[model samples]
Target: MSSSPFPDTDLAGNDARVGDGRNLDSILRIPVLMQVVLGSATMPVADLMKLGRGAVVPLDHRVGEPVDVMVNGRVIARGEIVIVEEDNSRFGVSLTEVVGPSAADQNT
Candidate 1:
C-alpha cells in the first residue's frame, strides 16, 4: 500500500545505490538493465534499399562526437569511442560523465 523506500531510480529498472559491499552483492543479484545500441540516423526506404557491399551509410554522429547513451529511451550519459584492437575485435567505450535524472522527470 505504501511507496517503496528505494523506489527504482534507474530508467534501466536496475536497483538503486546499495550503501555497502554486502548490500552491493545483493544489488548485483538484481537483473541488470537491458540495453540496445542504435546509431542515430534517418534514411528513406529508397535510399535504404540502394545499399550494397562497401556502401557508406553515414551516421549523424561525427568522429569524437559524444555517443548518445540511453537508458530506456532516456539520455543518461555520453562517452567517446575506444578501439580495443586495431584489427577485428570489439570496440570499447568509456563513459566520460553520468547525467543525473532530468528535472522534468524528478519526483518531488
Candidate 2:
C-alpha cells in the first residue's frame, strides 16, 4: 500500500494523500462527478402501497424546466431532460448553474 510521508497526520488534518504529491495532481485529472446522477427515493410505506403501474407519482419539477439534481440528498444542479438515443436518455445540467449551500459557489 502507498504510504504518506505525513502518515501520522490524517486527511482532515491536511487533505493531502502521499505520493509525489505532484503525482497526486493526476487525481484532479480524473472526472469530478462521474456516475453521480443515479437516484432512488423512498417515501412512506403507505404511499408505496398506493402506487400502481399506471399511477404518476408527481415529481417536484415542472415541464420545460430544469429538474433539481441531487446527490446523497443535497441539491447540486438544475438540468433539462434530453433523449440521446431511442433507448437511452439523461439530463444535462449546466455546470455554470450548479447550486451550492451559499449564494455563490466556487465552481461558478
Candidate 3:
C-alpha cells in the first residue's frame, strides 16, 4: 500500500476520485463521535433500581487519574480533566498521553 495525498474514494469508501472530480472533502466533512470517559461503574439491577435523585455511584478511577479519550470506539489518547479558565462553566481535557499510529497498533 502507498500513501495517497489525494483522495481515492467517496464518502462511502468507494472508488470515486477517478469517476468524478470529488476529493476527500466529503470524507473530511463526515462527523466523528469523540468521547471523554470520566469513569464507569457496574451494579446489579436491583441495586440500580433503588437509586434516587441524589444517588452517587463511585467510579473505579481515582480523583487524579487520567481519563481516556475515545474516538468512535477506540482509545486514542489519555488526559486529565480541566476546567476552562475562560469559561468556568465549561470543562475540558488536558491531553497528557497521545497515541501514535504505530504505538496504537502495538497495543492492539
Candidate 4:
C-alpha cells in the first residue's frame, strides 16, 4: 500500500484499521441530523401570529436557487433540489458544492 501523509490513528495514537484489529466502527455508526434548507424569512411576532391557511410567506431565495444542506445545524454543502428519477413522487438534493468549514462559516 502507498504511504499516507496522515495515517489514521485512534485516541491512543494506534492504527485505525479493520485487519481484524482496532477500528472506528462504533464512531462511524453515530447518527447526525441532516437538513435541507430552501430559505428563510423573518417576520414580527404579530405578523407571524396573523398567518393562517392559504397565507404565503415569501422566502429570501428565489426559484432554481441552491439550497443549504446542513448537518447538525452546520451548513455542510449547497445543492439544488431535484426529483428522484426512480421515484417521481420524491424529491432529492443534487449536491453541487461541498463547503469546507472555516472561521468565516462560524457565523453562518
Candidate 5:
C-alpha cells in the first residue's frame, strides 16, 4: 500500500482524517466575503451625472425577485431578502438555491 503525500492529520495534530468531521470543521471557520446582489442599471454619462439626493434609479429586477449571492466575486447561490426576525429590525438572505461550480462559471 502507498501513503498519500498529504497527511490526514489536522492542524490540532489529531488523526482528523479526510472526509471526517474534523477536516471540515477547520475549513468552515475560515471567513469569506459574502455579497448580495440586488440588481444593476446602465445609463449614459449625461443621465448618470444628473443623479442627486433622493434620485430613484430603476433596476432590472423586481421587488420580489431572487437575488444573486456572491462569494469572492463569484455567484455561488441565489436567495431572497428576509427579516432576521419577526421584529423586522435586521435583514438577512434566505437561500433559495445553491449554485454548482459549473453554473457559477456561466454566471461570472
Candidate 6:
C-alpha cells in the first residue's frame, strides 16, 4: 500500500478529507490572480494617444451595472462597487452573484 504525503487529520485533529478523501488545504493555499473589471472602452489610436490627466473615456457599462470578477483572465463572478465604510476613502466590491461551473466555463 502507498502512503499519501498530506496529513489525514486537520489542525483540529478532525478528518480533513474533502470530496473523495482528497486533502484540499495544500491546493487551497496556491494563489491565483484576481481582477475586478469595471468596464472597457475602444478608441482610435490617435484618440487614445490624446488621453491626458482628467480626460474621461466612455465605457460600455452604465453606472450601477454589475462588474465582472475575473480569476486568471476568466470571469468567475459578478459584483457591484461599494464604498468601504471602515475606510471611507477606499472602495470595495460586494459580490452579487457567484458563477456556476457552466457559466464560468463559458466565460473562459
Measured by TM-score, the strongest candidate is 4
Q: Write the per-residue lDDT of candidate 6 for residues 45-107, one digit (tens) a residue.
A: 999899999999999989999999999987889999999999999998999999866755669
Runs with alpha carbons beyond 4 Å of true place in candidate 5: 1-27, 103-108
When sorted by TM-score, best at the front, the candidate numbers are 4, 3, 6, 5, 1, 2
lDDT of 2 by residue, 1-108 (tens): 448554644555553444648447757677544333433465899999998899866554456655667655567776665665645655344443677675554446
lDDT of 5 by residue, 4-94 (tens): 8776665676877657675677688899998999999999999999999999999999999999999998889999999988778889999
User: What is the Cα-based lDDT of residue 1 in candidate 5?
Assistant: 27
lDDT of 3 by residue, 1-108 (tens): 439866666568777763364655766788999999999999999999999999999999999999999999888899999999999999999999997666657798
User: Which residue runs does candidate 1 get wrong by more than 4 Å?
Assistant: 1-27, 33-38, 85-88
| Predicted structure 5: lDDT | 0.88
Provide the lDDT at 75 for model 2: 73
What are the per-model numbers of colliding residue pairs? 0, 0, 0, 0, 0, 0
Segments in model 3 whose C-alpha atoms lie over 4 Å from true places: 1-15, 18-22, 101-108
Off by over 4 Å in 6: 1-23, 103-108
lDDT of each: 0.69, 0.58, 0.87, 0.90, 0.88, 0.87
User: In model 4, which runs have C-alpha deviations exceeding 4 angstroms?
Assistant: 1-21, 104-108
Instruction: For candidate 1, write residues 1-108 as lDDT tens digits.
Output: 329765644556654556634357666677645342436678999998999999987777777777767777777877877777765577766788778988888965
Candidate 5 vs candidate 6: the TM-score winner is 6
The candidate, 4 or 5, that scores higher on TM-score is 4
Q: How accurate is candidate 1 locally (lDDT)?
A: 0.69
- Per-prediction TM-score, please? 0.59, 0.45, 0.73, 0.75, 0.67, 0.72
What's the C-alpha lDDT at position 66 in model 4?
96
